[model samples]
Target: MALKPATNPDVEAATIELTIDGRAITAKDGVSLYDVVSGTGKIVPAMCYHYTFDPFGSCGMCLVMVEGKKAPVRSCTAKATAGMVVRTEGDDLFQARKKAVEKHLSVHPLDCPVCDADGHCELQDMAFLHQVTNLANAKQKLIPEDTRSLVLDFNMNRCIACGECINICKDVLMIDALQFAKKGGFTQVVAKGDQPLACEFCGDCLAVCPVGAITNKYSKYRYKPWQLKKTTTTCNYCGDGCQMIVETKDREVVRVTSPLSWKNKWGDRSETAKG
Candidate 1:
């Protein structure tokens, strides 16, 4: 039997071609340059560029050089266009990303050794990629940690204001539990009504957090990222059967996470399982 033609019109459309660092790449139109570049094995460093939520471009770590533009553009927000010329890596781009990383480290405490996200943290990976040996020499700002939440720990000192947690909590989850308060240097994430966090203990915010600012309070200091052996499985708690990544260390299951992907809408664990 002859197979029926693909029903999706978008699948048959011509792909957009773009150049990155002198290498040509083809991608579907309307997708961000960050997606295209990352799909081609050139991962752009970003703190607030989660695949589940809209790209906020709050962090400048994914800056890239675009033809005809004097200043570097954020790859996460820059759309892929036919014949577009992009430079993902160069001296200028490197310097810009380096400065961005340095600024984030200025107020961040050096708690990676003890932090739960030690090996898998994005900031730590970026620092290593850029060979950033020195933390910002500026006076570190000390903010009191908030531990009122029963499931997650909030450390203001470690937050870079990337807005991933706030965006996910408010926009994606439709839960107005978290928001950015204050201005300039005083701005920080706070629960709505200034009360103890009261919302779905989904832990989605903790999953998207780039830094250790928000972490699992129950599993805090239990095990390092490298110590765990990840096993992908399906949750059988309900009929939805959501996919889960179980982390085990020394034969003990330490933590569970719903792996995020383009196929997973809003990174909703329950919904993903249903699909």
Candidate 2:
């Protein structure tokens, strides 16, 4: 089953004119400025913003220069308005976004060699995209990994605190299993009440996590992303026939993923709950 948007299909949203990077464009009124920019085939690096939920502008990577604004605004949270002049790219914007990535990398531990999400981490992609190399006062979060959950491991050291996992769990799955809590003098994601994660084990959190903060215990250290050959197939587990991508490594099944993944973040909760 494919998830749909939450808007009414019968009624179309009103359109408004906006200028992005000096190019005039039309977008749905009241929609996210990020969405409008993305519709124009422009990519914006954002960690906490996903299409499945309301924008939580924790990562400042999606900063855009809006006319009359002295500082860059977060495009994900800012709504598109009529006659809005937006600049999505520039040296100043790049530097601002780079600083945001550096803030996360400064506190992050250098564990990509052993991390399961190394090859498929968005943080890695963003860092490389921004050419992040060195930091002035680099400090590492030496918090112990939380392996209490049977299905996943919570490594606070690698976490950027994007809140994507928590938002997806609450907004998309409606499970409300995860939350942000202050632990070890740093804000980290934990299960509600700081207890062992005991939820539906839907693995939505695993899929939406932008970094290796949350990793699958089953596939941990089993294979890198490049070793897996993906085969798109339907799930036979139930009659819902939810589409899934089964990854294999050398004839052995590695991990099974659904359409609901970090890459495919747009979906309606009503449609996804049915799956």
Candidate 3:
């Protein structure tokens, strides 16, 4: 069906065409690379790139090799340009992804066996996907639990310091308890609480967290990823309806992502891509 239509009609409406995985795609000039990727069926995963907050590329998870561009740039924030070639998964991407996984898993507690989000966690799915499709990664990368949330483990060892949790906590949720400190390998996520993290309990942080560093206590040991049956749909969380595909692995809501859009790159006019 046609995307519910662009809510507000007053929205520069720039235009451009770019190459994604080799196919020429046209889209609004200002639309983010994430919009283009999501518009297509390729389904590049993104944990922290939310439409509500300012686009922060700290997650480094959405990195896509841009043709003619030296380094892979973030699809979430980068503006799509004409004649641009976008490459998603590849050997170089695999290596980069593994390191990202290793970085997050390094400090993340080995709690999937006990964690509530085990079955539907995006991080777990990502790890499982890479391991199953590619050669498995180092088993010793697992880390121990650093902090506890009554039942959940808030391990810093698994954090990539994507700052997604922090940004969500600060900007979207306004709890501002979590923050990233230091630089380089020393960087770590911490709560400002004199007690525990002053979390608002939105759980968006848990949902957006790329690894198990942040977790849920209630769902621990309850479900498995493959056990859940996923269905593509929309987000009722708000009015824009934001066209999303919801995952229902175990007859419950799991996650959401962008839906097809005419304004989006892939959904753009077929004639435009060839232009």
Candidate 4:
């Protein structure tokens, strides 16, 4: 099922003045700095921070430096107060984000050529932004592939521990199948036991993963990023999501819409298409 959004519209009433990317703006008291920045159409790399869920700062990809604040704060968790200055991009901020991406890439399986998420992976974009060319893979490249009913190409090293999989499995989908297992270098979220993935097949985790760790087995080697285009429409397949379109070269559909079609689908939630 599609996760419901936090419908507290009054949450934005508590006003605070802020600046992002040299653009002045006003936002609510409790809204995360990430939301404020994103509201302005300024891109700050993020993975785990979802608008509908409580902020989990485990993914340090959205760190932004604040003026008068000694240390950079996690944009996903930090509330925007009155007169706060948030800088999304700069030399210093870039370096800090570079290190974060570097850490994520250190364990990432550097398989952009064959990985299923070659075109639209979030981590891949941020890595290029940070000027990260290649990573030192710690494991053998010949490991056997993981093929399940839906997910495939299981590369444990590609995961950056963004917790999107864990969050979707637990919070959004109400399934506790995926969990963190291990302490340091070998840390990962493997499926529990040898049992089937046991997921609702919502693909919410795949939607939020920063890397290409979890992918639909059926769609593997089927599509590329530049090969498809996202058109405005709703999804008719599920109870969640509005109609959306994927404009492909050969008139083929690539991706469907998610249920969170507030502005993207119907311009508001009240007009959500009945499934």
Candidate 5:
């Protein structure tokens, strides 16, 4: 069987040849350079990127060395060009990406012990993978948590300001319920007008948050990622057949989550608003 194209199947895009890590590869032209690199089975850590929406280069962890560029460029926002030579690995690239992760960690709170997204967090995984051991100047945000939402809680202290939630909400789902606001001397994601979250409560924001900034109110501090078993099934609420993950603890239903998450980042979720 032929492998499916990495880009959208609806439109026809020109094929382009690119070299990654000294290996030649062909990918869809005009697509994200990160997507092309990821298609080759190489995992480049990226916190602010998801296949569901356009690239939002907030995290800056997806840096790659291009032939002509003097410095490593963010691959997620860079478009794939023909006959381009790219390098995905090096001590310089690793240190560059590590510095990007350190910036987010500098202002992030150390609440992983009781955080709901502790085990399943992208930030946690990236920190461990990148060997982020010492942070002599790690400052805490200390912002108060926002629990006004009916189903979700916003903890600004733990937020990395990745904008994954805001991008997914605005670009893919079209809800545009969340936005970035300067509050308490920090940039934070908040509901529109800086008020309580009032939207479809689809939980896509919670799913895309790289850190423990946004969490489910229903299952907060109740279960860890290891304790829950996830079951992917069809959503019965609508006819669109949007897939969802049902979390269960000891055979008891805990929470219903959509597949549009940060870890399992693939596919187009534009039609998920109807779900």
Candidate 6:
């Protein structure tokens, strides 16, 4: 199913006009340039960006050329302004994005074929879209995978440190179970306390991960993204009638997921209790 972009309440209050890639567009005053350009035909590759979360501008993939600026700016964090000129595509922008992807690939594991997120991985898609064949640096440090969680698997080597997992767990889920520890290239997401995992088994972290770094333990090796057929339907168990995307393979249901907005309100409640 094609998901519509969520309306930004700030944009509804006021509107601003801007030019993107030579085409003029009017958007809400405070909305990010990335969100405005995303609605248009322009393609801006953003790995760390999620519409539901506040823009962190962690990944440099959404870099764009703004008029009167020497260096490209991150569209995900840049606010749209009246009379501002933004270039979404160009040879310079392409090279910049390609370089960013190459840098990410340097530390990332080249285990796409064997990874559970193989077919639907954002990093993999960006690498292919930008035609990133070789990394400027090829040295990859080994980081031990975390399998202490019985419901999920954590592979530190495959993480890009986008902060999505940590942010969603902290801000949205209200479960400060995960945190970013260390710095520089050695940074990693770790569960709080001495235990490997110290939060409820809501599996919300797995929903926000863009790579194979976090995945459901039960579905890890079972089915690829393309192998499953998705069906959107209303949840009969919930009074809220939350919509869910049910994934099935060969008539067998593999997994069920709902929008983050829906999950935020009633996610912690049991299925039977919500009915």
Candidate topping lDDT: 5
Write one digit per residue (lDDT tens) for candidate 5, span 62-168: 99999999999998888888899999999999999889878889888778989988888888888888899888899987888899998889999988877889977
lDDT of 6 by residue, 1-275 (tens): 22223225432346678888778777777667777787675668887776555778887999999999999999888877789898888899999999888888888889888898887788888889989887757667587778898777888889888988887777666778888887445888888753688577666577667777987777778888789998889878658675777889998998775455212421221111110
Tens-digit lDDT string for candidate 3 (1-275): 22311211135456778889988776766656766666666666555555445567665667789888888777877876677889998988776765565555544555667555555555677677556333334334334454544533465655656676777567755678777765344566766642465444545566566555665555434555455555656556667544554546556765442332111222332222122
RMSD of each: 6.5, 4.1, 7.3, 5.5, 4.8, 6.9
- Model 5 / residue 228 / CA error / Å: 1.1
Error of 4 at 132 (Å): 1.9
lDDT of each: 0.74, 0.81, 0.58, 0.64, 0.82, 0.74
**Better by lDDT, candidate 2 or 1:** 2
Model 5 superposed RMSD (Cα): 4.8
Q: Write the per-residue lDDT of candidate 4 for residues 155-257, one digit (tens) a residue.
A: 6667777676677667766787877777344666667774457666666666566667777676667777567666766667677564444445477665553
Q: Report the C-alpha displacement of residue 240, candidate 1, in angstroms.
A: 2.0
- Please report how far candidate 6 places residue 197 from its true position, in Å: 1.9
TM-score of each: 0.82, 0.91, 0.62, 0.75, 0.91, 0.84
Give, for candidate 4, the lowest lDDT window spanning 10 residues: 266-275
After superposing candidate 1, which stretches have Cα over 4 Å from the reference?
1-15, 261-275
Which residue pairs overlap in candidate 6's backbone? none
Better of 2 and 6 by lDDT: 2
User: Candidate 2, TM-score vs. the true structure?
Assistant: 0.91
lDDT of 3: 0.58
After superposition, which runs of candidate 4 have C-alpha atoms over 4 Å from their true positions? 1-13, 19-24, 134-153, 183-185, 192-194, 228-275
The window of 10 residues in a row where model 5 has the poorest summed lDDT is: 266-275
